[model samples]
Target: MESRELAYFVAVAEELHFGRAAERLGIAQPPLSRAIQRLERRLGVTLLDRANRRIVLTAAGEVLLSEGRKALTALRSAELRARRAGRADPRLVVVMKPGGDAGLLERVLARYAEHPDAMEVEVMICGIGEQEGLLRDGHADLAMLRIPHDDPTGFATEELLTEREVVVLRRDHPLAGRTSVRMADLAGENFPRWSEECPASGQVVRDTGQVAQMIALGQAIAVLPESVTLTLRRDLAVVPVIDGNLTTLLLAWSEESRSRPLAAFVRTAAEVAAQARPAEIGA
Candidate 1:
């Protein structure tokens, strides 16, 4: 009926003698006997068979003893699990438009590795619209973006870096040999196409003003992250589009978590982006 009653029942059940059970429980024999009597009264069952010289369990006492021990064990296990959950690390979610440079991805992962309090991170690669939706809905803690969302009144964006957009053309294309090409030069060439099959191409579609598939057909040129072009296809030549040279990449989040580890990650990422910029564009 109560924890104390169950404890008294168990103590007497195990020791099988009133004097010894009371000693184990740190109580006098008469009080221990009274507690067990109270438990049997609540359960409406006889628990022990007692004579002047000896004590033994009735069938009912044996049954209650088995179940009470099991219940105590389960209670302890649940407490331990709850404590573990309380101490677990926080998870960081990163959302971005699909297609990332492999080296940049590696660098981001490395920075997270250095944090002592890091938890498991879930990386969600989606279109800009989806990334914005996740941040607004609380599904993502942070996002990397070409342009930060403007609708959410509580959100804030930090400009991480402004890096040049590059033209990715098949190696044999005429302007591919040039050190740089302006956006206007490739007005009608069908450039790289975006499909689930080509993630790098998909990002080119989402970020640039031009149609990506039309660019792939060589009637236009595709513009993409200098990082994407640098890491993806060896046969594609990436050249900065002179006047078209830059895109402002930002790290965005809700104002509440802006001071947390998510912000720390944003700072680390800016360093990686600046270091990776030069090797990615001209040579």
Candidate 2:
């Protein structure tokens, strides 16, 4: 399908409202509707289920939405990479959440600079769940983030460090004095929701500081990477989450990325990660 048609479908699918999607795409509603109708006829499959005047994606639509996003991102990446190819001075952009690198970033950059092929590096501090998009869209040359052991990511990555999580709560909370606590020990305690799919959480948190504030106010407790304690407030206390899940802080980059500078940086990061595994090293 044409990029314009695919983009239109994606917009409509995300909004689930023709009017809002048209407004977002800067097009009239009638033409948008016709474009969708024509696309459905051409594809010979009903993408959206228009029942009871409500719009919902059909099974086929869901597959397209997932794959279409990748296609669009790949197309954008090609354009960006092509433009960078013609530039006189090419630089690398690294994206990560604040403190996501587990104190390895500064050292990594320092080591990479000593490499024979190192170039300019720009660091982009992003919010939760934005690193992958930035990398896929060619806005970032590399990323350092944590993921579940079983999580499947299509990016090219190298395992950096794996550590158990910790629990952050109000300094005066009852559990703050404990040496450690099991995941089950947190029962009935408020937790911040990192995403809509996460379960058994109270307030939705958009950033690290917001979650820290939630814990500082005694409104919520968060299970996070141990490195987060480095930035915790005076009113916040961190305790080892003895039985919490293991999170791996890894260096991630696009599968399509094949620059010499990118390779040098990734190798430097891996070398740095090897020597920096902290006290807890089971995972």
Candidate 3:
């Protein structure tokens, strides 16, 4: 089937609303409706179950949607690789959130530079929960993401580091003086949430910086990786959360990526991780 037809079918399948899908595709409703109808007829299978106010995917539609996404991702990856090949200096883009690398980014980069076949590496700092999308959509070659906070499915990943989590609170807060705290101690506390556009869960805030500001102002508290303390303002305090989940940092790349530079960088990351201090690298 043509990519365009697959695109149209996938949109409708995901949105489950013809009008919304048409709007997303920047097309009129009538044509989008006709296209889906034609596709179903061509395949001799009913793809969607349309009711008065609801739409659901049929078994065949579900299969198509799953496979279609992979096909699109592969196509985009090919296009991006082709474009990069034409560049004078082919570089691999490694995406991560600002201050999310747990102090290992510099070491990883320096190690990668020692490789004979290493290409220039570009770091793309994005917000939390965005790294997977960037890698999946072909905008980045590799990413450093925290497990549990970020899903690691559909890609290959190597664990670089893991650290104990800490709760960030105002220095004047009642529990801030403690060396460590339990999750139960902060049960009633307000936690800062990331912005609406970000997929992160919690009380709504624009960014990590804002979360810190809010904590200092006594608006909320947050549980984060211990590395966050390195950049915390003086007004804020980090108290270890003995019961909180350990945040693991990982280097992830798409399974479809065949870039030698990306492989070299991954190998370097593993070496750097191996050489890190045991106390800093966690269990």
Candidate 4:
């Protein structure tokens, strides 16, 4: 199917109303309706069900919507990646959460620079959970992502580092001196919720800086990757949380990317991460 038809179908499916979808698409309702009908006929599938004056997506419609979004994203990403490749200055863009690199970014870059295929590596520091989007949309060529899969979330990844997480709170907190704490000990603590989906008491915070600010004000405590401790303020204290999750650092890039510079960087990162010892948690 044409990308335009897929886009029309997606808009209609999401809005559940052709009129609204047409308005969103800056087109007339009649044309939008015809486009979707044409797409359905071409695909030989009933993509939408109109019953009792309301629109609902059929199973096939749902699948198309999901797949269509992916196709659109892929197209856009290809455009961006191609544009970057055509630039006079050859470079690679790598995205990551600030202070979330498991202490491997510096060492990785240093080692990768010695490689013959190395190019200028531009680091795009972002908030948590944002590296995925940057990579998906081709705003970045690589990322130091903290996910445990080799190919989860549609990106090809190589395992880089694995380390435990810890809780950070104000230094004046009663349990700050403890070398280790448990989930039970943090039961009553006001941990900052990094995203809106978290079922926590306080307003959502977007990054470590925000979490650190809240912790300093005694408004929040946070469980974070131990690598972040190096970036934390002196007033903040860390205690290893026994039940915290193990964050695995991965070198993530597009599955379709075959750039030699990108490949060399990934290989260099994997080698460095494999040889580097895990950072110790100090009391």
Which candidate should be chosen as best, given TM-score against the real structure? 4
Q: What is the C-alpha RMSD of each candidate to the true structure, in Å?
A: 20.0, 3.4, 3.0, 2.2
Model 2 accuracy (lDDT, Cα) = 0.85
Better of 1 and 4 by lDDT: 4
| Model 4 lDDT tens row, 104-143 | 7888888889999999999999987888888998899998
- For residues 166-241, could you state the per-residue lDDT of candidate 2 as single tens digits? 9998989999999999989999998888677778568776688898887777789988888776666888888998
**In order, what lDDT does every prediction score?**
0.66, 0.85, 0.85, 0.85
Candidate 2 wrongly placed segments (more than 4 Å): 15-20, 37-62, 84-88, 149-152, 279-283
Ranking by lDDT: 2, 4, 3, 1
lDDT against true structure, model 3: 0.85
lDDT of 1 by residue, 58-91 (tens): 8998998998875654455455434533555646
Against the correct fold, how does model 4 do in TM-score? 0.94
Cα lDDT for residue 33, candidate 4? 88
Count of clashing pairs, candidate 1: 17
Better of 1 and 3 by TM-score: 3
